[model samples]
Target: MTKAELVFIPFPGIGHLVSTVDVAKLLVDRDERLSITFLIMKAGVDSKVDRFIDSVSAACKCIRFIDLPKDEHDPNQPILLSFIESQKPHVKEEVSKLVSHSELSHDSPRLAGIVVDMFCTSMIDVAKEFGVPSYLFFTSGAAFLGLEFYIQALHDEQKVDPTEFKDSDAELVMPWLTNPLPAKLLPSFLLHKEWMPVFLGQTRRFRETKGIIVNTFEELESHAVSSFFKGNTPPVYPVGPILNLNRDGDHNPRSDRSNKYKDIIQWLDDQPQSSVVYLCFGSAGSFDMDQVKEIACALEQSGHRFLWSLRQPPPRDKMEPPTDYVNFQEVLPEGFLDRTIEIGKVIGWAPQVDVLAHPSVGGFVSHCGWNSILESIWFGVPVAAWPLHGDEQFNAFQIIIELELGVEIKMDYRKELFF
Candidate 1:
């Protein structure tokens, strides 16, 4: 009997790509008769993503990576939506070729289905053409999915303008939500004209898919999971808490890269158990000069052992390539480095999972990216939620207010009153 083969198409961002990769790993591990083909859409910047994918492929025999053809799109548009729209022709052509080739080979694993990232809802057309089921991989928790569905439903059934969320100060009352959600905690997209149409457009396409596999466990979000089953919505799977494998494997390439930062590990080793706080925002999270200075002052005042993964802002020209280095002296407080040299160590990029997994690390200051949130929870590290964009405000609410697992620092950088 032939084993089942599933194709996974994930949005190009690291967070989405990592969650989809873990889902692929989980699917294969749970069912011995399954194989996964991970179709990685190349990002505008590809080096780090390429390295990460290559490392995972080297370790897993059941998973394979296929690079989809890339196209140029408007930089101002939402990156996820732009990528999905631009890749339509390329994705269709590639999926057709993959399906055809598999049918021709008697020894090949049977094509079971296509699993697409939530952003790539339009890919369901390709699945329809091939007569295969398409499932959406919702990288966030089930609650976000429920909210998106409710918003989309409201727009279709009641002619409610999702854009009204922008100017309205009223509490968002949805049937699925147990309590009214304040306007401030809504996703940034819903509150901005530039992003609202694109977000709502994607949400509308979601109902057309055959099923959705969310990255959250049933027990953790039972209410949210149950809410997704209203009327004609597809089957929902709460198959998560799925995380990256432990980084301690000697043969692991991610850890091999960590060897370059032996000093950082040594610093963690010197601290008392669970004594250090790890501060890292996601790829897009970075502070201005004023914010950086304030953080430096706070770190110095606290006198806690710290590891901060700091990132400089993106280039002003979207088309311009990013620089490899940033001058820490220019952005940080005056004499900040010298003063906190004994207490805090700041670096550009960090192996976050490894840092959080460390015995000496106790808490995380995060941008509330869903992947980072899950990683923090997996390591049993408490969070100081500092959400930057998208659904981060909603996630901060989930963590700090609803769940009582973390604390919230205000999202406004100008109001940087909290340490």
Candidate 2:
């Protein structure tokens, strides 16, 4: 049989890359005829991503990783968007080389398609040049993708900007959702006029792809997934809960940060089953000192067995890897840690999935990132959501208000999402 191949261009983030690789693993495992090549974009500031690539390479012979040369970033456009756009030429170059190689090798697979991450829609041009079908891999749930489509159509139908109502307290009756979603609750990108066009533009390009493969299933988002089937849109494939479950093999290998959270896990081993409340925001999720103090106070007052994954706020002026607070005492209320020492343990950047999966973990007070939400559901740990940013607010809305699966700490991302 002739070989078949698919090229993957995941967004420049570890989570997106991991999920994309997971999809590739599923594909190759199901059909031995197929092999996938990942055109890895240089994104992260550290070696964490590189280490993941190395580990995955060792584990999967069917997958290939080609790191593209670092392109000069465009300062005028949005950072992530600009970075992705700059890689177009590099991606095209790599794909061309692949075509050349395949042409020379009798056994090499014929290029079947290209899979572009949702944010990397710009790379569709490369697929068009190669005469290959381009499928969009959406890392978030179908509900959020539906919201993007809804917002785009909503703006197009009225020929009005949704940001016009940014100041008012208004709700939108969206087709994908069972109830009206508050305008205030839409992702912050849609609320601001500056970012509105950028995100809406990306959403518009989604329709241009051959199909969209969402990291979700119909059962998880029946309404939203159904909406995709209603329109004359591209085919939708809900092949998800696509996650990297091999925590033991994760490149971190529990080498760098494992020591940090081992004590917390040991403490959890002593706790009763379903007795500890686990509070952790996603990797990018963090709070200001005021929010931290309020959380400590609440945990102190409740006297519940808790394991809090406390983190420090990011640099005010720049985006970088997560910065867990230097000292919990500096951020927490004075003496709060000592008083609650018996009942709780606050650790920096807890192994979130591990913590959530623990039998002792009864509940998750989460930032409601789509991934965090999925992990919580997967573990059968209930969630009290406080959406931090981006599509998180929308995710929180979907689970809490639409699906009735979770409760809300607050609907406002601007305010404290504390207990």
Candidate 3:
């Protein structure tokens, strides 16, 4: 009997790619009879993405990575929407070509299906062309998906104008949702027409997929999940928290690149068991100079030992962090390093999973990305959610308000502090 072949196409973002990689790892581990191929966009192959691919490939023998050419327009540039629109055709073509070639090999396992990120809806047609089932992977929770679907229905009913909803002080209540959701709590991106088009377009494509996989547990969001599938017969799998499945592996990787911040691990080792806090806002979240200073002050006052990952803001011309800001600690609050020498550690970047898993680490101050939220929960660590932007607000809402897993921090004009 031939093994089943599956191709995973993840959205070109850190959180989405990470969650998708976890699912891919899980699929291959459950059954050796499955072979997996990961289709990565050319634009998504950055240093971080490459590192992740290497880590997963090392652990899973049945997994492979296939890179496609990035769109001609830079993915990091300001005109992101234009780039995605222009790149859609190429993405479809490349994926179809790969599937066709894979089918030609006599020894190849039959193509079982394609698993696509919710954002990568362009691949649905290609899956149809190849006569294979395609599944939509919503890298977020069921609540957010329910919100998007409701918004789409409202738009179709002509009850709401996407542009007017941006400023209208109306609170949207969707009784159909399993949980009580307010329009105000919907993803902030939906407020604008430009962003609405992207999401709504994706949602339109999502309805066409054969099935949907949400990265959550049935026990965690049963109400929302139940409401989501009430009428829709498509298969829904709540096969998570996926991060819990890989807790046994040793994640440390040795490299010549000495993490200029090795003191973090040493500090963590010194702390009392479950006494220290780990603070990280992910790679994309940023704060202005004033906000940075305020946060530094708050961490100093918190009186608990901490490991704070700070990144300097990008230069005016470039999207990448300024070269000089690479040494992040020097710019911190005056005497910040000297004052907290025994209790606090500052690193530009640390192996997040390893840090979170450490025996002494008890709490996380996070940007509330779904992957980070699930990881914290998987490790049984409480969180101090401080979502800065994007779907983080939604993720934080679910974890802090809905699940009662953590505390939410309010940002005041004076400083960034946790209560």
Write one digit per residue (lDDT tens) for candidate 1, span 67-118. 8877877677665567677887887877777778878987777778999898
Tell me the lDDT of candidate 2.
0.81
Residue-level lDDT of model 2, residues 1-419, one tens digit each, is 88999999987566677778889999999989999999988754645567678778988999999988877667777777778888899999989988999999989898999999988888888999999999999999988888898889888877868787676788888777889888888877887766789888888889989999998988889888998788867899999888677752332325563465667778999999999999987666788778788888999999899999887765653435466677888888889888988889988766777788789999889888777778888889988988877788888888888777888898666532211
Top candidate by lDDT: 2
Scored against the true structure, residue 162 in model 1 reaches a CA lDDT of 72
> How far off is model 1, as Cα RMSD?
3.6
Whole-model Cα lDDT of every candidate shown, in order: 0.77, 0.81, 0.70
RMSD of each: 3.6, 2.9, 4.4
Model 2 compared with the native: what TM-score?
Answer: 0.93
Candidate 3: worst 10 consecutive residues by lDDT?
410-419
Candidates sorted by TM-score, best first: 2, 1, 3
Q: How accurate locally is residue 26 in candidate 2, as Cα lDDT from 0 to 100?
A: 95
lDDT of 1: 0.77
Per-prediction TM-score: 0.91, 0.93, 0.86
Q: Is candidate 2 or candidate 3 better by TM-score?
A: 2
lDDT, candidate 2, at 61: 94
